[model samples]
Target chain A: MEPSDEALCQRVAKRDVAAFELLVERYQGRAYRLAWSIVRDPEDARDLSQEAFIRLHESAGSFGGRSKFSTWFYRIVVNLCLDHKRKRRWWKPWAGDAADDQGESFLERQPAPVTDPVDELGREQTMKDLWAAVDRLAPRQRAAVVLQVQEELATYEIAEVLKCSEATVRVHLHRAMNALKKTMKNMEKR
Target chain B: MAKHPETDLVPYLRGELPPAERERVARHLDECPDCRQDTDQLRELLGELSRSIAEPPAVNWARYRAELREKLEARRGRRAWWWQPVPLALATSLAGVLLFVAVWGVGRQVPTAGDPVAFEEAAIGRNLGLLEQYQVVERLDLLEEDLDFMSDLDGLAAGRPG
Candidate 1:
């Protein structure tokens, strides 16, 4: 039988890479997809999800098991996605830097040369408009909506992930759907 | 008592509603076009989102797993000999003590601004090898502060020219 997430986490606390790999295998899909849904960039999502695993490895020892392992893990992934989005939104291209594994500094990685967003729109209008509308929502609202529509998490589970009340999750989803509807309307006008 | 049952449309579309709440929202939707529009619009967005984001593209899980293992190993292996926690902690404590002693030593040498005598005494204590000459230096300093004695020296030098 596969070890429970809590049991795997306990082993991970002892620096067991195998245990961590199990945890990663179990959650990587949700982590990557949740990140992709929020950030909308494939590489960024991959990086963010991997970073979440790295973080889980580091902080595994500190896990008190107060919440379920998935809940705790999702919190880490969601926070990283939100932080990455905020950093990308405020960051300017070709200014400042963060270093990579090889100690090479890279300036902000944004405005990622869409070459022609219109070309993208022509290729997949439905997917493009849906993505654009989701992106238009506020971060938490976007997160709430994505968790609902894509992750298919119930409102209570989303509340656990978001660390908020179920009511607040509902409010966020309501606002996000409204905003998305408005965005779709505006896109049609254009 | 959720006054805004339209908020329930999201869960309704997701089929998360229980049978009773589902029936109630369904009945309400039948009566209200606006709520029906809400359900339809969100349903369309959810359909697209589910088709795309829900079904994430195939990731190279093998490569991803290998890279993550590499990173985990690197992170766990980061401490060189000098970076060992025990030695680093010991070295940090030693440096902290040395720094405190250096600061306190400096504080002792620096007399408060209002106390010239303490400053002189400290200077004298530091150069005890020059004890015999310190009195002479003090007298010379006093003489330099004497304007009349300086003017006499200036007059003498003016007369002598050399």
Candidate 2:
């Protein structure tokens, strides 16, 4: 039987390296995807995911088991992403399309070679649309939506991640989905 | 209580409505054309969402997993060393900060060695001397007033006494 996350957490609190590794394996992809969804950058997501795991390892003893392991884990990832956003708030592209297009082209050039054509195309388009829609959302709404839709966290789990009431998470999700629907409708027109 | 079919449409589309509420929405949708059309669109959007799980970029899982192990090992290794508890660290930091502030405050409060105690003493002496001088000056003024009163008393006595 697979060890429960709580069991793994207990071992992790005891400094069991294997338990920590298992925890990392279980959470890294979801954590990375959550971070990527928020920051919209692969490098930032990788760094944030690693940072979160490192932090979780350091702070495992403080886990109270009051919430699900993933909820607690997501709180770490979301806080890191919020910190990155706040830090980058002052820097802006003063110039127009030249800078914007340059950034896009740079990102395009870095995309890995497509292994499966269909999957690759779908992944690329979905990521593009998702990020574009997410970018238009308020920061909290974006965080809520990403945690809910992509990470498959329930409203209560997202509330823990967001440090808000579940009702607040629901509201954020509703607004985010509404905004996304509007954005998608506009895209469909074009 | 069942919410209006329109009100529950979004949650229903996400399959998040309670079972009874879900049935109510389904039943209402069969009878309401507008709600049915709206539900179809919302269902389509939800479907697209389910279909749109992006493929994660290619990663070297062996390498990634190895790196993760190394990270956890490093953390455990650090924890084993000195084995500092968080509360202890927090207390130590708080103590260090308080000690720094106290030292800083004392450093500011006490006079430094640029001037000797003799200089402070001399300044005190000068201030004391000025105070004494003022006191003497006041005394002299009082003496003048006494003299003027005595003269006035003499004048009154010469004019009124037998």
Q: What are the per-candidate TM-scores when only chain A is compared? A: 0.76, 0.78
TM-score for candidate 2, please give it.
0.61
Number of residue pairs clashing in candidate 1, backbone atoms closer than 3 angstroms, sequence gap of 3 or more or interchain: 0
CA-based DockQ, model 1: 0.30
Docking verdict class for candidate 2: incorrect
lDDT of 1 at A14: 97
**What does the lDDT come to for candidate 2?**
0.70
Residue-by-residue lDDT tens digits, candidate 2, B1-162: 334455456566767767987788888887777777766766666556656655446566667677766776787787664566876788789999999999978864444568689568656765776676897879999999999888888988889542
> Which lDDT value does model 2 have at B153?
89
Q: What are the candidates' C-alpha RMSDs?
A: 13.2, 11.1
lDDT of 1 by residue, A74-169 (tens): 889999998886686567433221221111011111222232335655426646655655665667887887777776778888998898997788
Off by over 4 Å in 1: A93-124, A183-190, B1-3, B6-8, B12-33, B43-48, B52-57, B79-83, B106-162
Specify the poorest-scoring 10-residue window by lDDT in model 1 chain A.
A100-109
